[model samples]
Target chain A: DAGITQSPRHKVTETGTPVTLRCHQTENHRYMYWYRQDPGHGLRLIHYSYGVKDTDKGEVSDGYSVSRSKTEDFLLTLESATSSQTSVYFCATTGESNQPQHFGDGTRLSIL
Target chain B: AQRVTQPEKLLSVFKGAPVELKCNYSYSGSPELFWYVQYSRQRLQLLLRHISRESIKGFTADLNKGETSFHLKKPFAQEEDSAMYYCALGDTPLVFGKGTRLSVIA
Candidate 1:
C-alpha cells in the first residue's frame, strides 16, 4: 500500500462547486500521480508531481489542478466541478521511474 | 507515444481451466509492461511485471518484444481470480488499457 492514504473516501457535490481530494503518503516517494477511473476509459492520469512544487499535466488534465507543497502530500483540485468529473480517483506513488507504483484505496466523487 | 490495448472486455472461464488475459503495447523504445488487478470496489494492485520474471498469485507474464505484447496467464483459474485486470505500459505517465473483467465460474 506504500502507506498511501486518500482523504474523503466518498464525496457528492453539485456542479459548479469546488472540490478537493487529498493524497498523503507515509513514504517519501519522489513521484506521485493523480488518476481518474471510468467505465470505458480506464484510468486516465490527471496530474503528477515529481517533487515538492514541481507538477505536470497529464492526458486528461484539462479540468484538474494539483499541488504538492511537501514530499508526502499531493492535492488535486477541481476549480469548478462538473457532472462529467464524477468518477473514482486514485493516487499512486513510486520511488523511482522504473519501480512499480503503489496505489491508494481511491476516492469516489459524484458530481450531480 | 505509448499505448496499451486489451482486446477483451470480459472473459469467462470455468474453475480449473486455463486462463489468459491478452495485452498488447505500442511503443518505440524499450517498454516496461505490467498487469494489475482490481477486485470489486478495491484499489488496483500489481499482479506481475515483465522484468521481474516471477509468478505472482499463480499468474505469470512474459514480455514478448517481438510481438510487442505482455499477456498474463495461469494454468488453472480459480473463483477468487475473478476481477478487473488492466495492462499498463510504463512511461512518463503510465499508459493503461481499458481493462478486462475475468469471470471464473464454478
Candidate 2:
C-alpha cells in the first residue's frame, strides 16, 4: 500500500518485440527492485537500483536490463521479449538496508 | 550463498486448529529471516521478521539457528489465514523459498 506504482498493469505483446515496464514511486525511497513471480518460483530478483544511475544484476538478470535515471523511477527493459519472460513482475522499494520492502501491485505481462 | 527451503508446497487446516508452516535455511553468516504473506488479490507483504520477534495476527516465527529453521506457527487458525506464505532470508536482497499455500477450511 505504499506510493509505488507500476505502469501497464496488464500487457500483451508478441514475441521478439521490445518492451519496457515502468515503476514510479512517490516515497522517495533509496532502493528499488524488480522481481518476477512465477509458479514454483516465489519471486526472483531481476535487477535493483541503489540510487540514481546505480544498478546491479540479480540472480535472474540474463534477459532483462534496467535503468534508474531518477530517485523515484526504475525502468525494466527487455531488449527482445520472449515467451519465457511472460509473468507477473513486481517492483519494491525500501528506505534502509534492513527495512521491509513495500511492493507494488505488479504488472501482468503476456507474450504471444 | 543463502538458501531457504520450504518443505511443504501446500498446507490445509481447519479453522480454530493449530497451524505450522515449516521453513529451513542454509547460511554461514548470521541471517535475518522473514515470513511474507500474500492474500488472494493482494500484493506480497511482510508478516513477520526474526529481528522483530513479535507476533503478528496471532502468528509467530522463532529463529532456530542450530536447526537453521524459522517456522511460523499459530495456535488457532482463521479462515482469513488462507493464503500464500513465503520464507525469505537476508536484508538488502532476500532469497525466498518457493512458498507454501495454506488453506484454512471453515
The native-contact fractions of the candidates, in order shown, are 0.53, 0.55
Lowest lDDT 10-mer window, candidate 2 chain A? Answer: A94-103
lDDT of 2 at B39: 92
Model 1 CAPRI rating: medium
Q: State model 1's lDDT.
A: 0.94
Candidate 1 residue-wise lDDT, A1-112, digit = tens = 9999999999999999999999999999999999999997888889999999999999899988999999999999999999999999999999987678899999999999
Query: Chain A: TM-score in each candidate?
Result: 0.99, 0.98
Clashes of 2: 0
Question: Model 2 interface RMSD, in angstroms?
Answer: 1.4
Give the residue spans of candidate 1 off by over 4 A.
none
Give stretches of model 2 more than 4 Å off.
Answer: none
| lDDT tens digits by residue: candidate 2, B1-106 | 6788999999999999999999999998889888999998678999999999899999999999999999999999999999999998875677789999999999
Which residue pairs show collisions in model 2? none
